[model samples]
Target: MPEHSYLGLASAMHRLTELVIRAAMSELSFPSLSGRASCGLDAACGNGDHSIWLAQALLPEGQVTGLDICREGLLQARKASAKAGLADKLAYIQGDLHSLPFRDRAFDWAWCADCLWPGPKSQGFLGMDPMPVLEELVRVVRPGGLIAILFWSSQRLLPGHPYLEARLNATRAACYPFQEGGSFLDHILSAPVWLHQAGLEKIRGQTFVADLHTAVDGQAGDDLAACFQMLWGRAMPELSEADKAQFERLCHKSSPDFIANRPGYYGFITYTLFFGLVTSRPR
Candidate 1:
């Protein structure tokens, strides 16, 4: 497997956590039962930011276990868990989503964000379809367990918005087969309906919409540019040297104002978080 360094990717992922938090806060309602005293699970927890956040929110006696397919990501998550002094209450694991490697009904709350997309050819990570992974998440949680998931939505991000659009286009140009048809809605939103198929009840699905805001002359703008580069910029590497150079020149020319953080460069990027919850009843 080609080791993709997510160090840069992690930063963008953390920035997007705000979207996930808002989704969890609004879409999914906690049971009258205490979340703090409850145990939780984070599926496909890349770097574990969501897990750590949940731990802080549900602290006092709650524990959160984060699982990821990538070992490097898991290691980073473990470090974060420890740094937060949550090592004792938090756990990180390297595991396949198809086979969760944990017992059934193991948790009360489950959370996962933006992980249903097909893996890259170089990574050979998870496949395009998330059905198997979905089954596992449903299986691991006990009856009455609260399950919250956010999958990719429609093309709300700009050409400047990173990751999904670029990756889909690149893979298609390279002639790769993707199951979800390159749209976040096609992939992630399908989960709510899938949960119903899996016999999950009280299935509620909603789109959490938010706009990305960046100041013209601040760290957020710098971070946004860096993120766009890390996610979509890398796809240009596959271009021929001359083509890459011309493309870079074109990009620079077209987005001079945006790159320079001009006042008008600030624009709203809209995204919808597809969140679903299921009562832990037996199917």
Candidate 2:
């Protein structure tokens, strides 16, 4: 885990690439998404992991431009894309998602992942109205181009501690980016409605699950630990002493009674993608 980082974004994503790739791309048909598109946009690309993969898998010959507002993230993205041999097919840009720095209808396709958790001033979420961002996404895509927005929908960890897990989820910290002051628009399940309201056609959604069982030692274990940390680290203060002890025993890799070390251990995380096609603007 990286110091001063809430989620240990880069390291976690790296260690979880196996599940990440499957969970993110499982429902996607790259051939159908690509077709005759010559250029693609990875909007708000955090580390460019998905960008590089999408470039190689979705557009074998087309260029994929990754856009983000964070300078450091873009720098890391540039490095990662280069390291993945996608330096030729990938480019990184520092830009805001709500105000994409591209001409109208500039991209043939667009992909944005884990970027639309909504709350007032929430760092993890995009922290504002997602409608503006959706509108911007629609504006820049060609009339017939595809636009996909992905959300890290849900996860069921702690196989036997459903009650404790539920308590953890009830905490405001655990639901940070999805706390109070949000409407139906903030909910991930309403994504198709968002796309339709933003003037996109053929809006649809699909969810992919990444399941793992009793993983210990290796990237999977590390990733599982990171997932536990990311989901419940901040919620510790809200938990009771017993709950805290249980969480520590289960989530801490150093604990003698870690959950993953037990037999029949199973956990799964889900990623949901909602996509729509840009439509011609009214004359």
Candidate 3:
């Protein structure tokens, strides 16, 4: 089975993305959530950091609900929310993406990060597929509400991005079936067109790229270690010993080149984040 655990490096990467997202939001004039207006939804809010950010953005009146299928991730999100003292403004649910638990036209907007990927490693789960979940996120939000989905960009266009390259390498080696694991770029570069096919409209999208910097006063060591653990740990359970060993070696060796500024070295990697607005029309 594919690993479901969120790596610390992934979390750090996510936090960095959050920073860029907030900056982009400010640049885009995304209205701040007031205590009395503008509710929000975070689709597939793994570990709740993004959801909590939404909830915090709401302040006193703008409430938010986060939904995800992973009970463990949800639990972590809940804890984080509570710790941040935003529990009252935020709520969470474990639900199917094909059929969101919210009422029709419930939310003003929805945001999901890395949620629309293919189904979980386990069978018999909804939203293990990207297309339907995309449809559902668009469906639940009121017309004109915005949708933001973030994912790793393709390596070819952003070759300096080590994280994206590493992730793609590990995933490909793990034998992910889709041409791109149903990537964000695949959906975003094609924007409202893809959403149009999913029965969404007025789709406008913008892409932002941020470098995933690991070097922070020697924190790179732990960051790389956690990334390796997240990659190999999740894979080892299902892979053959030979494959597992090879993967281990790969994970172990990947950090050094990036760390020491050796020949053929690349700096912090880039991640692509995409945001769009859902329209009233089907296309």
RMSD of each: 5.2, 2.8, 5.7
> What CA RMSD would candidate 1 show?
5.2
Q: What's the TM-score of each model vs. the native?
A: 0.73, 0.90, 0.70
Instruction: List lDDT for all candidates, in order.
Output: 0.61, 0.76, 0.58
Ranking by lDDT: 2, 1, 3
Tens digits of lDDT, candidate 2, 1-283: 1213522456565455446564565456555654653688999777777787778766467788999877778888889887888898999999988789999989888898777766554334565578888888888888878888887777788888899989988888776666566676677788888888888888888877767765443456666777788778888999999999999998998888877777677787777889888886661
The pairs that clash in candidate 2 are: none
Once model 3 is optimally superposed onto the true structure by TM-score, how far is the C-alpha of residue 127 displaced, in angstroms?
5.5
Report how far off residue 3 is in candidate 3 (Å). Answer: 6.2
Over 15-72, each residue of candidate 1 has an lDDT whose tens digit, in order, gives: 7446556555444544334444778788878888877877776746877889887887
Least accurate stretch of 10 residues (summed lDDT) in model 2? 1-10
After best superposition, candidate 3 residue 27: deviation in angstroms? 5.5
The candidate maximizing TM-score is 2
Native-to-model Cα distance after best TM-score fit, residue 62 in candidate 2, in Å: 1.8
Better candidate by lDDT, 1 or 2: 2
**How does model 2 fare in lDDT?**
0.76
